[model samples]
Target: MYTDALRAEWTKLRTSPGALWSVVALAVAIAGLSALAVAPVTCPCATDTTKLTLTGVQLGQAVAAVVAVMLLGGEYGTRMITVTLAALPSRTSMLAAKATLVGGLVAVAGTVGVGGAWVAGQAALGDELGAGAVWRPLVGSVLYLVLIALFGLGVAAITRNSAAAVGVVLGLLYVAPLVTAMVQDDDWQERLQRFGPADAGLAVQATINLDDLAISPWRGLGVLALWTLSALLLGGVLLHRRDA
Candidate 1:
């Protein structure tokens, strides 16, 4: 049953032209932005090269969120979610299948984007590429994109509206960081940076200054995972209890 559910979700995604193009757009946005970021750097020493190379993730995540939100929210918007629930019957299996399929697609696109960014960085940065730099941020960046996609899926499931879901996810990713910067107290600012979804998640990209970061790379990722999982769980509970 689970396997069939997964296959059905995959079929729906592949057949949707918007979903297909969104993945391509995501890859292009990430790689292109990373290349642009690398091109301006005359001195690699002045910046965290790994983070700069993966800078595209900031924009790419927005695209990922849109795709994920549309996966479910589009159905809701069209009132097709009723048909979907009627077909699947089990809300848990259905939601899980959607999450899995969306996560898989985002992971593939992220791999391409992050891998391209690394190759671009290597070409542009040349000898400045640290021996330890490529692997962690490369892998972490991919995971970051995947998590952002799942995060979007969860939020969309809760809101059940494409526009609202997109707005909420974008605010979480972009606005939270700016809000963190506006805090008057340094300690509170640091705390916000450590806990804020975007700031904490992007911490995985820091290869140069581990000690200076408010949260360690893995722990920062953990903070994001908590946020993602909480959203998913809340969505799941509401989905189970509510009428389609």
Candidate 2:
């Protein structure tokens, strides 16, 4: 039954034109932005090359969020969720199927985007990137985007509204970082930077200046994972309790 539900969700996503295009857009945006960021670096000393090369993840995540939201929220908007629920019966399995599909799709797109960004960086920056520098950001960037997409799916499941879910996820990703920057207290600023979803998650891209970061790379990614998990848990509870 669970496998069947997964197949149904996968099939739905495969058939949706918007979902298909959004995945492509995610890859393109990440690669393009990373290349653009790399092209401007005349002095590598002024920038963290690893972070610069993977900068596309910042913008690419927005598209991932949109794709996740639309996958479930589109069904709600079109009154298709009711039919989905009727067919699946078990809301838990249905939500799990959706999350699994969203996570898998985002992972594939992220791998392409991150791989493209690394190739672009190598072309623009040459041998500046060391052997130790390559693997973490490359692997972490892929995980970062997958987590962001799951975060979106969780939010959409809770809200059951595409527009609201998109807005909240964007604000969490983009605006929270800005608000964290504006804090007068250095301690609070540092704390927020350590925990804020975008700030913490993006820390995974920093190959150099590890001591200067507010949080460790893996730990920062952990913060984002916590946020994603919390949202999904709340969403699952609400999804189980509420009607379609």
TM values, all candidates: 0.97, 0.97
**Weakest ten-residue segment in model 1 by summed lDDT:** 127-136
Model 1: pairs clashing at backbone N, Cα or C within 3 Å: none
Query: Any idea what lDDT model 1 has?
Result: 0.89
| RMSD in angstroms between candidate 1 and the native structure over all alpha carbons | 1.0
Q: Tell me model 2's lDDT, rounded to 2 decimals.
A: 0.91
lDDT per residue as tens, model 2, 1-244: 7898999998888888878999999999999999999987765465688888888999999999999999888999999999999999988899899889989888999999999998998898887754347788899999999999999999999999999999999999999999999999999999999989999999988877799999999999999999999999999999999989
Candidate 1, residues 9-72, lDDT tens digits: the string is 8988888897899999999999999999998787647678778888899999999999999999
Q: lDDT, candidate 2, residue 44?
A: 48
- Backbone collisions counted per model: 0, 0
